[model samples]
Target: MKSFEYLRPETLDEALAALSDPDAASLGGGTNLLDLMKLGVAGPERIVDLARLPGLDRIETLPDGMTRVGALVRNSDLAADPGFAAAFPMVAEALLSGASAQLRNAATVGGNLMQATRCAYFQDPFAACNRRAAGSGCDALGGANRGHAVLGWSPACIAVHPSDFCVPLAALGAEAEIAGPSGTRLVPLAEFHLLPGEEPHRATALEPGEIVLALRLPAAAAGFAGNARYLKLRERTSYAFAVVSAAAALRIEDGTVAAARLALGGVAARPWRCSEAEEALAGKPATAESFAAAASIALSNAAPSGANGYKIVLAERLLARTMAAAAAGTPAEMPALPGSLMDDTGEAAHA
Candidate 1:
C-alpha cells in the first residue's frame, strides 16, 4: 500500500480542515478508500478519518415523520433497523441485497453513497480508461464491456454505478445532508450523483472538503402501502454484483396503481430513475400487461454494448418480474447471468 498520513478527528471542523488540503482525503468506513489504495488506484498523501466525528452516527425520526440517517450508520444496522424496515422497506430491501452480512457490518451509509463505479477498465491498470486518465481513450468501447452501461453513457465513459443503496434511495426520493467550508447544505439524492457527460472522472457533486452528514427522506414518501420489491439479477445467488437490477415501490389503490417509483442499477453511469415507466403505471391497474408496458417504456432508449446486447431484454424481463411481484406481494427469483461476481477487482486504475 502507498504510504500516507492519517488523522482521526473528533470534530467535523477538524476533519474538514484536514480534507481541505489538496493532498488529503476523507475516510468514512474505509471500505472503498482502503480497497482503492490497495489497488494502487488512490494514492493520497493524507487521510481524514471521520469515524470520531460526533453527531454523525445518530438515526432519528424527525417530528415531521421524516427519517434522518447519520452518515456513519452501518449498512447492516440500517437494513435491520425496525423503523427503516417499516417506513421504507425499499431501502431496507436494497441494502439486504448487497454484499454479505460481514461486509455490510464494515460498510457505512456515506461510503456506500460515495462508492465508485465497477467498470473493469477503471480498475485495471493496463487498460486505457478515460475515467482513469482524462485524455486516455476508453478501452471498454472495444474491450470486454458486457457489464458497462446501457443508459446515460457518453463516449468518455460507460462505467456503471455499483451502489445498491442508491437505487432505492433514488426511487424513494431521499435527500442528503452535507457539510463543507460553506457550512451545511442539502442535496436531492437524484441530483447528488452526476452522469459522465464530459468529465468521467468527476463522479459526484461533493465539493472539496464536503462530507456527507446525513440522509433525509421526505415525509410524503412514507405510507405507500403497496408491495415494495428489490430484484437483483446477477451470475450468482449471493456475493455477486448486479448485471441488471430494479428497485420498485408500487402503491395500488382499489386494484389500480396509484403511484410507483422505479429505479435501475447496473445499467447507467448513475442510479437511473424510470420516470416514463412511472408515468405509464400511474392511474393504471396493476397487471402483467401494465408492468410489461412500463418496463418497455423504461428500456425504450437503452443502448447496450456488443456482448451485453442481451442486457436490454434481461433488464426488461427483470423489471417486469419486479413489478409483477410487487403487484402480487411476492419476491421474484433472481436471474442467473454470466460474470456477475461480487469481486470488482478487475477494474483498472487511472489510465
Candidate 2:
C-alpha cells in the first residue's frame, strides 16, 4: 500500500478540517478502506482516523422515540444490542447476514454505509471502470457482467451497491445525520446513495469534508418489528455477497396488510425501495397472492443492464418469499443462520 500521512483527530472539528484536504480520506474501522488501498484501487494522500471521536459509538433512543445509532458503532455491537435488535429486527438480521464474524466485529456502521461496490471491474485497477475512473469506459458493460445490475443502471456504470444493512434501513425509512464544514443536516437514507446516471464516479450524496454522524430510524419504524424479514440469496450458504436480497415488513390488522415496507438489494446502485409495491399491499389480504402481485409490480421496471436478466425473475420471487415470511411474523429469536431460506424451518442448513 502507498504510504500516507495519518491523523487521529481529537474532535469532530479537527476531523472535518483534516478532511478539507481533498486528498484526505476518513478511516473508521479500516475494514474496507485498507483493503482498497492495498489493492491500489484507492490511495488517499492522508488518513483522518475517526476512531478517537467521542460519543459516536452509542445506541440510544432519542427524545422523539426514534432510535439513534452512532456512526462509529461496530456492526456486531449494533446487531447484538438487545433493544435495537428487538425494535429493528430486520436491520439486525441484515447486519448479521453480511460478511463473517471477524469482519462484522470490526466493521463500523459509517464504514459500511461508505463502502464501495464489490464489482470486479471497480476493484481491478487494470480494468476500465467508469466508477473507478470517470470516462474510462466500463469494461463490465461487455465483460463478465451476469451480476452487474437489473435496475437503475446507465451506460456509464452497471455496478450495484453491496450493503445488506442498507436494504432494511431503506425499507424502514432511516435518516442519516451528517456533519460537515457548514454544520449538520439530516438526509433520508433512501437519498443518501445516488444512482449512476451520466456521472458514475459520484456515488453518494455526501459533500466534501462531510462525515456521517449517525443513522436515525423513526419511532414508527419499530411498529413492524413483529412482522419484518430480510432474506438473501447468495452463491454460498454464508460469507458471500448477495446475489439478490429483499427486506420486507408489514403491519397487519385483522388479517389485512395495513402498511408495508419493501426494498431490494444487490440489484441497483442503491437499496431499491419499492414504494409502488408497498402501496399495492395496503388493505390487501396478508396472503401469498398479495405478495406475488406486489413482487410483480416491484420488478415491472427492472431491465437487465447486461446478461443478468435472470436477476429480475429471481428478485421478484425472493421479494414475494420475503413478504410471506414477514406476514408469518418474526421468529421469537434470531435464526442460527440469519437470512437463509432454510432457516425458516427452524433447522440448521449447514453444519
Best by lDDT: 2
Between which residue pairs do clashes occur in model 1? Answer: 122-348, 123-347, 123-348, 123-349, 124-347, 124-348
Q: For candidate 1, which ten residues in a row score worst on lDDT?
A: 342-351
Query: For candidate 1, what is the total of clashing residue pairs?
Result: 6
- In order, the Cα lDDT scores of the candidates are 0.81, 0.93
- What are the per-residue Cα lDDT tens digits for candidate 2 across 239-270? 99999999999999999999999999999999
Prediction RMSDs, each to the true structure: 6.6, 2.3
lDDT of 1 by residue, 183-237 (tens): 9999888778888898988888898779899999987677553477677788777
Residue 101 CA displacement from its true place in model 2, Å: 0.5
Please estimate how well model 2 matches the true structure, expressed as its whole-model Cα lDDT: 0.93
Q: Per-candidate TM vs. native?
A: 0.92, 0.98
lDDT over C-alpha atoms for residue 8 of model 2: 99
Question: Candidate 1 — which residues are off by over 4 angstroms?
Answer: 330-351
